[model samples]
Target: MPESWFVPTIAAPRRPIGRQVFDFDRQIVVMAIVNRTPDSFFDGGRTYGLESAVAAALAAAEAGAGWVDIGGVPFSPDTPDVAVADEIERVVPVVEAVTAVSDVVVSVDTWRADVAAACLAAGASVVNDTSGLRDPELAAVVAVSEATLVITHSRAEPHVHLRAPRYDDVVTEVRAFLAERIEHAVGLGVPESRIVIDPGHDLNKNTLHSLDLTRRFAEIAALGLPTLAAVSNKDFVGEATGLAKPDRLAPSIAAAAVCALAGARILRMHDVAASVAAATMIECILGFREPAFLAHNV
Candidate 1:
């Protein structure tokens, strides 16, 4: 493995998400993805049902995930817009089920304030807005709920694609966008300690842009907030390695390790067990965690 350089300059030492506390200074948190959408790119609607989504969330918690992100709508522009009521119905039940059984932090992934508010009331502690707050009211919802907010960098509107997205410097632009969004959220009454940033790996960006963001992710981390890396099974990983979505685990893990080494505090992933193992190993290697056994050295 390459020499680990996982030092972080986070603005806060601990981030409270609902009932869970993330000590970013000492750990790399694995936030498992539980998509409630039937047409989601990765799982292909595997966990779309309420029972299945709840099971997946519990399974992820059992597999050592620190958080479970539940999404009711796919971010792909190809999918039709889901009504606010439908979106809330799809995700809130799952959130209620998971939070009732596990202490795992639950995050509702949506760009709509109404959906976010409903999920927060249903026990979601984090609002993972991949749209970069296109609906600014979402910030007020998070602020009122005192929930953590993940400000992702995406240039396009929700469910819309940017025609030929361009950035003079992908990393710099992403960093700036996240900073501005964080300021907006704080202004709406959200605290900086409850904020996180994501560079939004492939959302509105091509393969080259996503790769560039991953290569220089530390710059995003330098913004001094908990940086989230959502690089699991993304198109950029497939494009770079010529592997299809189902076969992208190896490259996905590699990309996640790169991001972790680059100072990412949270990893949003689909394969919970594998991701948890990778994160634990990286933590041990970086001296943040001690090995479980020392039999070989003795």
Candidate 2:
């Protein structure tokens, strides 16, 4: 267990998502996945259309997710490249619709600057750069907008498969990479509070590497900044438990529990309801959140 947990001082000034501000110190933000791509590994394009995507976002909010990460492209190299205009087309309407109807924070999962700018304009409160800022200009767009930036660590460019990438120390390297990117984003005028770091578990790492990062997640949280764990149905979790994508929810929630115990503040997941329940339990255990109704236990 960590000596100190949920340190609010490490987060940026309250991050505004429309009218709501997320206080990372007191909240475990559940960012529900809403992939607009037809080829997403998890959903198989279930929310590919505008209406379905908007519905998905609203449903997640209803299920207790504080944020919805809408992505128009998959990071796998096997997935085809989406044109900037088409990417914008796929996400903007969803962003606009979700923001219009729900108070949940909307985050656009894109590595393209143009697509990011358009989504931010459409009312996304965050830009989740899964490619590790492959497009240098993406940071500038986030810097200028009221949106926050999620800088993840990926060893290769978007869509390129990383075959057994080596690292002297996986945790140390991820921490260093995220630190540099955070500094770079701040240098570009993004406030430190408006920035969050993700170690990019399966984004560029193998099963063992992701497991190590999750186990040593306390080190990442020690940076005193909000860290995001996007472990929902990821290959690492599947590989670890021999579960397929649809059946990985149990292990996914288990990994999320470990992440929460290690002090990770954000959990990006596909099963919003289950993740919220698990996170709520973890939060209560950590004393960061109290039980809904204290009865006999009190």
Best by lDDT: 1
lDDT of 2 by residue, 1-298 (tens): 3553333345463566656777667678899999999999888999998899989899999999998999998888888888889899999999999999888888999888999899998888899998877677998898888888899999897888888899889999998988888888888888887888899988879888999999888888878788899998899988899888879999999998888778788999999999999888877886777789968956
Query: What is the TM-score of each predicted model, taking all chains together?
Result: 0.97, 0.95
What's the CA error at residue 115 for candidate 1, in Å?
0.5
Q: Write down the lDDT of every candidate, Cα atoms only.
A: 0.90, 0.86
lDDT of 1 by residue, 55-171 (tens): 999999999999999999999999988999999999999999999889999999999999999999988899999999888799888877779999999888888879778889988
- TM-score of decoy 1: 0.97
- Which candidate comes out best when scored by TM-score? 1
Q: Give the 10-residue window scoring lowest on summed lDDT in candidate 1.
A: 1-10
Worst 10 residues of 2 by lDDT: 1-10
TM-score for model 2?
0.95
